[model samples]
Target: MNLIAVYTTLIVVLLIWIGARRNPLMALVEIGREMLRSYKFILIIVGMFSVLALNKYELQIERKMHLAADYTSFVFGLEGHFVRHVQELFYAPWLTPVIVFFYIFMLQSVLAASLGIYLLDKNRVLLYATCYTIILTYAIAIPFYLYFPVNEVWSYVPAGVKFTMLEVFPRFEQEYRPLSGLNNCFPSLHTAISVSMALLAFRSGNRRWMVISGISAVVIVFGIFYLGIHWLTDMLGGTLLAVVSTTVAVKLAKLTLRSGEDRLRVRSRATHTR
Candidate 1:
């Protein structure tokens, strides 16, 4: 089963448990409300995955890198001009991978918002913020991917600079190898997702976790460049995407809340008049 099916099943089970114990009607109503509110986010994610899948079939088209090669190269030159040093301060194989894994997993901000929804019984703000962030990031990224398709500098790094473990990692090689095509490296999804998680952590009032995540994000950003998985320009692009996405998400959340409040006030006044 796909992720949608799995998540739907889990939600159904939770609703069933809620119905069995306290109030079935209220549980159904609550679930319906949440589904409606989050529908846009679900659609965006599905659309992104569909685009990625379809791109896989057009292998010949992807191989050309005609989409955004020159623009990406220019941006990369600007980033490379600022590189001060290439130091390997932290080189633990186990540690880097583990940190990277956790950072990626944290991008599932929906799960965090869901927890807030369950505990506080009102997390529309968090839900809206998370959804908006995801949607905005991909929306902004799609054009850049087209205009500046970049194969990471790491793809052609000097043999001596290549990290040993990364060079040998089959899965990583398969995903990023330039020969296989699909190399849009101007913006690092890793950095965008990491920054998104850090923002969510902060908004959720988990300052301690936010600080830790912030530090981890910085490490991952550096690690990706150091490992040659991304160009310095790619990291900058990722940072820009994250900032734009977060800003847009916040504005959207505020608008949603304001609209909700206006509706509630109108209803209250109508009831009072009656």
Candidate 2:
């Protein structure tokens, strides 16, 4: 695995341990059992990862399309060097690495740990709802990425924002740019996914998970602008998307799971009568 993968895996494992108070291996075994016991669980997991994989493919297609309409000017117009001001206000040599770490590593760690933590706590409803939330997040965001192309704040020179990410990950453009397009700045997924995960965790009834996810979300959101990667408008758009996605995903998960329970209840009654 690459250094990024290794670092994220370590962070995820640590988060799962702290939140669930169990070895991640044991939690994985339980997760596997849960998946085996319910096809719905398996399907939701598959669907969630499928959307993530599709997002990677979408980045490739976006690069090939050479999308010509840069809305960076429009976004900068609305938010007028907000990211630069943030960097100027908060920038520090010591703080940059901390912000960059959260910006890069913590988001994925919290997301991965959310799954293990939910399963270990036997919170099936929240687990399934998270999957749906992820699916909805990408489904909604991808269209904006494809058509409403907005460049990163630092990339628009007029914004006067420096790409602070390069301080820590000097090879960011070489290594990470392929995974993320320069122009996929609107409705920052970093904000949406992290905040949405925290929103779902609040309903999980696992206080530890709630605390962990909550702090991670807040830090990741702040890290966006501090890293000079996102605009104020992007963060605002992402927050709105987070609220809407989690709200809809929770309702849909309850409706879908409740119907499945009803079917199982009917089956149980028919078997007992026979």
Candidate 3:
């Protein structure tokens, strides 16, 4: 992934969102100004990268743990019966293009859902919460990645089953493996992030985004499964992670708000007493 393109696109999305309410040129300048003023926004980016960097180092340890552990049976046995049907349905020749599209576009969907709420709906609380939820997911997942480095389902194909994300997207391995460790497949972060964005969109009171995000999240779940990148259990793990992270993010935002309010209340009392 070209990180620059990803962020540049996010910024453009932000500009477009702001443009809806103001002059397009003014919206662009205002977004630039807001980026400069919003230390929290910068900090959120910093926090996400910090966790990601830590992941590379931690994955080394996880790799060692992977060599020492045998978790394939544990994970595969728990995979639901419907997972096979899902794989069969998704692996169809005609659906190959759709699966590939969803695999790559899932992150953009997340950006749209979360940033749309912030930029269009003007819900800073929900924005902060969404960022926090994303980071919290990383924090939670890294530990699992470290201890339980389950390989992708592609490595453990059942009799008569096939895995095609690699076959279809020939460059995927060369491109994706460099950035991500091979064994970080226990709980799918893509699924978790997508699901969390959907949840937040619903909570954001924007019906349009809610529908869009909800549908995108479901597609992403199937995309991961059909691509043989994750098992049914990974999606379940991701869903649970999303719920936990969203709850934590909401609490974090509320706590920050409460603390700010308390400081203001203290100042008011101090001024009156003086």
Candidate 4:
């Protein structure tokens, strides 16, 4: 079996083991539940790996579908127009990575909040919403990556322009290069994930967190464009995905709750009668 298949099997086995520890019947149910919760994340990770594998093994496929040249050129042109303005406004030598780090950390924070709420009494509404949003974002993003794979503008911009910006934020540019990829720029995952966290904060009744997330999203969106990591269109796509994913997650969570509640009621009655 391929690595994908192997990994999928391992995940399934792990879930089963986790479920069985609870009780055989409960374990079976939990396996299904966990699969529903986690399948989207798995698929997204798989899609990324598949892209990497294909690039490694299939040059022809990469050449045919590659949007690197066009996307990079477009972003370069856009950045050229706004680069100076952005630098004047927010291009601090030390603040760029701090902002980026906070953006990533917010994702973890949102995940923790969602999990905490679920553990505190199983708020299916929140649980479903969070998982569904994450899955939906992955689902939408994978297709965009396949169809409109774009490299970061840093890959192809003129050396003169690159060096000028690098001078202002040398450390920021260097630190960003290792973590940010050239491909996967059509729909900015940063924006998508940021919006996801913001929406989650809103849904979970953390108004303060929502405000912080909103501000962070705005900053990250600016950072992405100003840094030439993504185009404006990519940010728009991320926003759309965030909205759609959050909506779907809320709906799915509601359905799951209804089903779970109905099952529990029936089980309780049966136990009483016995």
lDDT per model, in order? 0.54, 0.83, 0.67, 0.54
* Candidate 1 lDDT by residue in tens digits, 44-121: 446545654544443455446544355535655566623223424555566656544443333343334233332233
Give per-residue lDDT, candidate 1, residue 159. Answer: 19
Q: Which residue pairs in candidate 2 collide?
A: none
Worst 10 residues of 3 by lDDT: 265-274
Q: Residue 160's C-alpha lDDT in candidate 1?
A: 27
- Give each model's clash number: 3, 0, 0, 0
Candidates' RMSD to native: 8.4, 6.2, 7.3, 10.1
RMSD of model 2 against the true structure? 6.2
Per-residue error for 146 in candidate 4, Å, reads 2.1
**Top of the candidates by lDDT:** 2
State the lDDT of candidate 4 residue by residue for 1-274, as single tens digits.
1443454444434332332222223434543565576564345435545654543343344457664444556555664545435545766658756655544344444444434433232334655566666666766776656566666544554612232335444564455444444566767777887787677656554444446567767777777755655566678889888888887777666665565432211112223221
Encode model 3's per-residue lDDT on 78-117: one tens digit a residue. 7644556677764678787777766675565455435543
- For each candidate, give its TM-score against the true structure: 0.63, 0.92, 0.79, 0.60
Error of 3 at 240 (Å): 0.4
- Over 1-274, each residue of candidate 2 has an lDDT whose tens digit, in order, gives 2999999999999989988888987778988897778788888888889999988998777778887777888887887977888889988899889888888899888888888887776666677778899999998999899899998888888999888889898998998898888889889999999999999877765677778889889989999998888889889999999999999987777766786442221112223221
Q: Least lDDT summed over 10 consecutive residues: which range in candidate 1?
A: 265-274
